[model samples]
Target: MVQNIKTNLPGQGDEDRKIRERMAKIKHKILVISGKGGVGKSTFAANLAYAFVADGDSAGILDIDIHGPSQGRITGIEGLQMTINPDNSIKPIEKGGVRIVTMASLLQDSDQPVIWRGPLKMKAIKQFLGDIDWGELDWLVIDSPPGTGDEPLSAVQLLPEMDGSVIITQPQDLSLLDARKTVKFSQTIGVKVLGIVENMSGFICPHCGKRTDIFKSGGGKKAAEEMKVPFLGSIPIEPAIMESGEMGKPFVWMFPDAESSKIMKEIAGKIRAELEK
Candidate 1:
């Protein structure tokens, strides 16, 4: 869970200046968000960071899922703790091509619950943005909590210059509904909708190399077309992704040639191209 920010809240004017000062050093800030939970959002964010890293760019990840911080584990920095620098800024934990900060890493125990109200949650997220020493980075990937609620909204509000948001969903109607809601939320908030990534669109059988659309397919493509957003690409559900995540190793690195890894790499490239454009 997030640290206590209620007592140490900053003055509004000063904090805004500090936040802009900090963000000025970062080039691109992209948020990976979903309308519903359990859609592999964190995983996508992690691998995307790794993809940028693999491309020789400096990247950082701000895992803003206050209640359910999974980027710590996904980025293989689960047990790591943030330290203080000479300037008293909280140092983000470094691993792979990404430096990371997550509420889970601050917990003394893994099972601890972060029971916080809206104000407190907002304060903590602000601190993560204004207080962390992100230094000069090519990309800052924010893994936001599900829904159009406080956490995700706070990230959008805090980073006014954020590049865009990537919506994630599975190939199912229920998931597509949430995905559409997310797209609308981004549009309503006036943030750019970079594109949509259809995760878990199908399952690839390891033994036979055969593909199965267990969740039914093309829903994400259809939804994106209807919504007039660019459809980034589809990532199939492979056993390797699950296995690697459980082992605290990002699959894109562990299985560089795997089908899903290639898909994620392509998506990352597309995002870079969009940012360039």
Candidate 2:
């Protein structure tokens, strides 16, 4: 059950303690971050959450992308919306048995925008952590906005016990360069780099069934090797992925037998193994 966020109620001190205790019971907290945008970080987070739930585990995806919230879309639950409970805490919407929280759900309308600065971002992150009752989740997948900016930093600081961070990047030189900066930022903050994910490594021509290096693949693997971080594998670019995202369905869920789905599941397995170790 989702708990409501209460305002100026009696016994507020005791209620706060209960919330903290509930949060402490969660097993794993993972942040999916990227230094550059358009690299499919939200998609990765959503599919990973779906895979976990599909396997009978309870998971949630929290979108800390204040300026560009899209996890609800990736999960195919866009426009459904969330509601604030009597306690004043916002309840996360559930889809396919996976609990999700995003700025999109909190918006007054689809066209609304979140225009805020550093302190505001920090406060929102804190509210999502301290006020909301997330219950006991096996995994909490947080999709952060691009770069090692205020949002990502705030999330890390709020959850001091985060298991690690997964960095997403493309197969382009420029993207790899920025991704390196993300790796360094994580290291500086004492967060482990679980691995690097290469999104859009190649594109498959529908008619030819041939793989083309649209963005010049292998850069991410090379970067991972040079940085001494594990390589989680690559996700090939497919037009179907975009179509699926638009239609409110993840490619992995829509076509679990497709090549892209296979890769995503493999990456999820690697993440699971790393967390276990």
Candidate 3:
């Protein structure tokens, strides 16, 4: 028979207090989440943070993906170890004008699997929030692993005063079905749904400037309307977006002239307006 595990670990109260104190310094907190993976959620999170930074706000990305952390690689800080301050607080790595913390920096090998259970994953996320020296940031974009699981739950429970969450979904029926669940999950947990982003909404031909509905567009906006949440905007699929990530650069910052970049900037601006209001 399986034995019961204690819910309260040692120093749990201390960590909770520390988390509150640290989070208080950040002006706005946004969680980027999806119902399932492979919808460019992480990419959107990274670029969203950069977009805020580009608009003259200090931003940071706390990658809580745990088992599949990609912000380090996407932000171009992979393989860089985090430093500790004399006061014992962990320092976040700064790159491309945004500070970042990810499990990627803690791993000895890139291919090493996280192999952690729910409670263990929660503890790591807590430490990242409470123990890290995030300093004063205008925005903290949290990139949570897809689904309404342990990592996202832990973050939501810890950050009760968070601004809201931005749900990322593709423009397809299968993805839209999961996106609806994601919206309901936010509601069930008492977290406000800031908006839904239709990523990979379409493909823009770079050479001929023709638009192709590769994934069939407008589903995300329709879902947002049905659910009564704001529809942030759509980001088209662009070759440059993929290349920018591979090169450890955010597309919005690296290719400001690209159409995708302009749309992302508009989305960021809407979020900023909502929060600043």
Candidate 4:
């Protein structure tokens, strides 16, 4: 993807300086974060980057979920390793229209644990922003690890001009409680909260053709209203979404014509509109 750059990108000396130089080419950056795990935050981040691809814009997924980096597998680029460029910078692996950068590519084994402390993780994240040759991108969608931990904080601190954050949550109260904390974290950091996405909002029985509140519905929207943030959209719990992930493809692409995909697209559209403002 970086075949046209003629400048000899030198080795990184000062981290902050390098990140400022590299991220300048990216027009927008979105941090997909959640307060807790199992909220499908990474999956949403992957699909969102690909959604931009479907819209004919260049995109990249930076899976900063250090310990559980899933963007490589989710974007169908699992097992692909990062290549070193002649200028001594690491090249991001491309799949379809999205460039994917993940700790998954750096690990020798898929099941190997990261086992890093805060300082180490922060260094790795710094290298991701500073050393990777992301080139010019319309969007850089980052999948931050759950909670307001070092990974997420490091990402926010690195991107001085980050567009904002996209918070993900489920329909239950437990998730909502933590989601509120997420909103507060973004505010405390001076980063704007772009919106919230309610994932696994409802489920439709494939056989009965009936909808069920498997996880209890409407809490996400209610929370957004109470928090005074934009509730982007709700995504139904479709079995195909899970199946698509297991098969290493995004649900939005596998079921582009389905109801879930439409909702996701609408949410993506809403996010784009808000960002363009």
Using TM-score as the measure, the top candidate is 3
Distance from true location, Cα of 148 in model 2, Å: 1.0
| Candidate 4 weakest ten by summed lDDT | 1-10
Residues 1-277, candidate 3: write the lDDT tens digits: 1111123223458878898889899999999999989899889999999899888999999999999999988889988999999989999999978999999999999899999999899889989999999999999999999898888887877787778899999999988898899998887776789999999999988899899999999999999998899999999888889889988999988987777888888999999998888
Ranking by TM-score: 3, 1, 4, 2
- 1-277 per-residue lDDT for model 4 (tens digits): 2121113233355766778788999999999999999899988987888777777889999989899888877877789889999989999998877888999999999988889999899789889998999999999999988888888777776675778899999999999998788888887776788888999988899999899998998878887888899999898898888788878889877777888888887888888899887
Cα deviation of 91 in candidate 3 (Å)?
Answer: 0.6
The 0-to-1 C-alpha lDDT of every candidate, in the order given, reads 0.86, 0.82, 0.89, 0.85
Could you give candidate 1's per-residue lDDT for residues 1-277 as a string of tens digits? Answer: 2222233333469777789899999999998989889889999998898888887888998999999999878778888789999989999998875789999888999898999998899899989999999999999999988888888777777777879999998999988898898888888776789999999888878889788999988888988998999999999888778778878788987888877888888998999998987
Better of 1 and 2 by TM-score: 1
Residues 160-275 of candidate 2 have per-residue lDDT tens digits of: 67788999999999988978888887877767899999998899889998989989999899889989999999988889888888787877778888878888888888888899
Top candidate on lDDT is 3
Among residues 3 or more apart in sequence or in different chains, the pairs in candidate 4 whose N, CA or C atoms overlap within 3 Å are none
lDDT of 3 at 85: 98
- By TM-score, the better pick of 1 and 3 is 3
